[model samples]
Target: MLRRNLPSLFRFSSSASASKPVNEEKSRSVGRKAVSTALFCLTGGVALSALDDLAIYHGCSSKAMEKASKNQEVVHAIGEPVVKGPWYSASLAVAHKRKSVSCTFPISGPQGSGVLRLKAVRSGDDSWSTFFQSRDFQILILDAVLYVPGNEETQRNVKINIADNIPSPSSQACTRCPETRSPGKQ
Candidate 1:
């Protein structure tokens, strides 16, 4: 009986020892899974960042286009001003007897107030030579559309105000040249 009991106890301890290796294998598999998941997430994040950078480099990102689509206001033809109330007002007109186009807009927001004036001349070939002006700088644009972002309330309040044609005090100085050449000379 002692001999039989000894063999049974030996079998029990041997089985417990065998299970230790299985437990270790299971823990190793779990660690491998955790590492795999981390690597997959890291690769995906890097790929997404690269795509975003590419989009921005190409001019308009998906995020920016999405925002622009949501906020864009289109003005059709001269004399049709796009007014977004309490936020901005924009108007386009043909000036100098249809030889030039003028686009004017006023911006008001938490940042401050300023006016944007754009002037374009029709070339002999029917193309446009455009100029853009803001408080900070002036630039020439071959062809471009201006976009201003605003909320629904401000857009709703916008209307066609003829007074917008009147230049602001700051702009008056630049637009007027002291009536130098006599009012009827040219």
Candidate 2:
């Protein structure tokens, strides 16, 4: 009787041990699948973020090009007022041999009363060459017109500003140089 019972006991212990390993293996497989899914999601999110940034950069680049192209044209030829900012607006109209720029600003406020400076450069040039500047002698009026001594034959890029003071661009330090130097120096 004892020998018969011993065989049955060994059979039961072996089956229990076998089933335990199978259960543990199933759990490990489930864990591995979860880790893989998480990794995939993280990688996809990063890729989408990079794509969004690239699209934004391209859009901004295109807009900047459009603005530059528009600026290259004579303001008066377009028959529309090009507003520089909330404080000022400008328009261009041809009269005889001169190009007249009509700039309007608010008649009230600290910024309202200032010397209006007009600057221009030849179209398609990065350098602010062909320098033409004039001060609006009449500070009491809401509208001021500046005359550029050129006809429609002369294409230019125009910029307008209203300020109590105008600082020289050369007065600032050159970004190309490591140290600040006099305007005369390279």
Best by lDDT: 1
List lDDT for all candidates, in order.
0.41, 0.39
Residues 1-186, candidate 2: write the lDDT tens digits.
999999999999999999999999999999999999999999998996555433333332233223322431223322234333233242222222222222322111112221122322112322335212321222211212323334677643334332224432434456675687889998
The deviation in Å at residue 40 for candidate 2 is: 1.4
TM-score of each: 0.28, 0.31
Root-mean-square deviation (CA) per prediction: 16.9, 21.4
Relative to the true structure, candidate 1 reaches a TM of 0.28
Q: Which stretches of candidate 2 lie over 4 Å from their true place?
A: 1-14, 68-186
User: What digit string (tens of lDDT, one per residue) describes model 1 on residues 149-170?
Assistant: 4576543332221222353333
Q: Each model's number of backbone clashes?
A: 2, 1
